[model samples]
Target: MPQHRNISCHLYIGDTKAMEYNVHNVDNRSTAHIVSEEGQTFSFKIEAGTALMSAARLDLELWADGYKLDCFTFTESVYEVDDAQVRDQVTGAIKIVKLRFAKLNTVDQGPSNADDAEAEQLKRLGTLEIKLWRSESNVSQSTTFPYADCPLQTPIHEKKIKGQSVSHVTSLESKGTVAQQSSWGYITTKIDPYDRPWVAFVFKHASKALLQSEGIVPKDEVKEKGAAVASAKGKKAQSSRAKVNDTKNEESKVEDVKFDDDVAAMSQPQLRQEIMRLRKRPGDSLDQSVVKARRTMKCVRTPDADNLLSTAEKGDKRK
Candidate 1:
């Protein structure tokens, strides 16, 4: 029978104490559930300008049987290395780093004793040390931990064999691709002595409104503040609009008086020029003035109906 061991992972940020969690070897069938959980997972928000020196440095360590096995560090100039600039919402700048582990068998030298062989079997898995690096070559970019180039190859038994009674040998390993490994390497962080998977941490900025929207901030406080802001904005907008309307009314009255005086004092050419100038001024109405000016220029006038009737009656009596 194959021997199994429990592995635990711990995370450290800067000089802060390490946060430990158990590591899990997730089955392929349970990957969908893991992905769903990660998708629905929300993070705690840190307010803007909140100085947290620990967030700048990150370290991850893996241990087995209370012995430290692997250590991954990102403590050197973290802010300068990555573009984790959190401007507004907590979801603005998200960094996800996955650490993959591999098993290495102990090579047999000269003559291996029974005790040595047992010890090697117990410590079969090898340690992995990682240092983070940034990639800025592509338009669609991300912070990547390159562990795919070095993979520990191993083989497992395949259940289905083509028309054969015996099981066939097949490989059981990940190539560190999104399709091959959709999770941020699993860890068993439970207290019930069972293996469970846990997703990694996310770092981002959080404002009052953003926190309230994500249910991190109190809803009542956000609502009251939002209402106050809206009320103040509405009053300011109304006052500005009223001032604009009054200015427009006064300007319109002044324009009408000016136009009437210009037509009475100026020649036909000057009146036409004034009309053209008024037409060029946007939002100025000169329909009545233009029509009256055109009629006077043409010397066209309608006689009074009373005078015309009196003249027609006198002509009829004479006839």
Candidate 2:
């Protein structure tokens, strides 16, 4: 997470903020070093900056692996964004899609053209950045924007790609489970964007091993000896507690929980609301219709994080 102008932002991987390694600040920008994994979903959350939220109009841009995903705006009324917004082109409609981390593969052209201008683009890879800009007016965003059309970098020569380790890049997730935003909105106005952002949050993310190889995060740095010992003791205590309680067992089965009628009444894509309604209940029957609905739902359903999110209360009531 990085903070500037009383505004703080953190990269989220499945609802939890990615663990930041080395964090430092310089002027209007803050950089955090983090780790990410392939196939895992990711997003960003912007905390409301009271003063900035009250007085200024804002715009946000999300960039990952040199590809700018989406641009959103905020006004006095709307000051923050919940999840990262990505457009889904698969559907002919202007629908939003989810993004997940994936291995960034390079088209190797071997070591001869190391000085090529395209190699410069590699510098932006393995980094996730969010820019906060001061806008003159609320903007009506044109469906298509310049950044979205930016071309991906050309293949780097083989020699340059051989030794360099590029970690992961954002890839579209077909089966989306994140629901941070019910819908996205923009303030419609025609205006040029600011030359520079008011503040910037840069997150340099890669695999932990790669980060350590580059010396960005130290390797074998077990300086917290006491904490390590304490952690082990805590784990032992937790294990003892788990023996008498089904809390841990029940919590881990969050993905196994079936849907309810209310959850099946929603609109749009992802899990078909109709299939959700077919879930067995006191009055429900597991007949042909429900069976067919269940088959249709196999493509969209995912582990529902919300079911076990209430930390204070948990466990099945069955005695």
Model 1, range 110-169, lDDT digits (tens) per residue? 433336543442332222111222212222222342232222232312211112221111
- Write model 2 residue lDDT over 1-319, tens digit each, in one string: 5777777887788878788888888877899988889888887778646635444566778777766777876665334343343444343223344667777766554556645554665667778888877655545534433224323334445455556667776665444533452343565432334556667899888888899888887766575677788899999999889875777677645533444333344344334334444443456664654555544344335344233221111321221
Q: Which candidate is the best by lDDT?
A: 2
Clashes of each: 4, 11
Candidate 1 Cα misplacement greater than 4 A, ranges: 1-219, 266-319
Off by over 4 Å in 2: 51-54, 76-95, 107-117, 137-147, 150-165, 174-193, 218-319
Which stretch of 10 consecutive residues in model 1 shows the poorest summed lDDT? 28-37
**Per-model C-alpha lDDT, please?**
0.32, 0.61
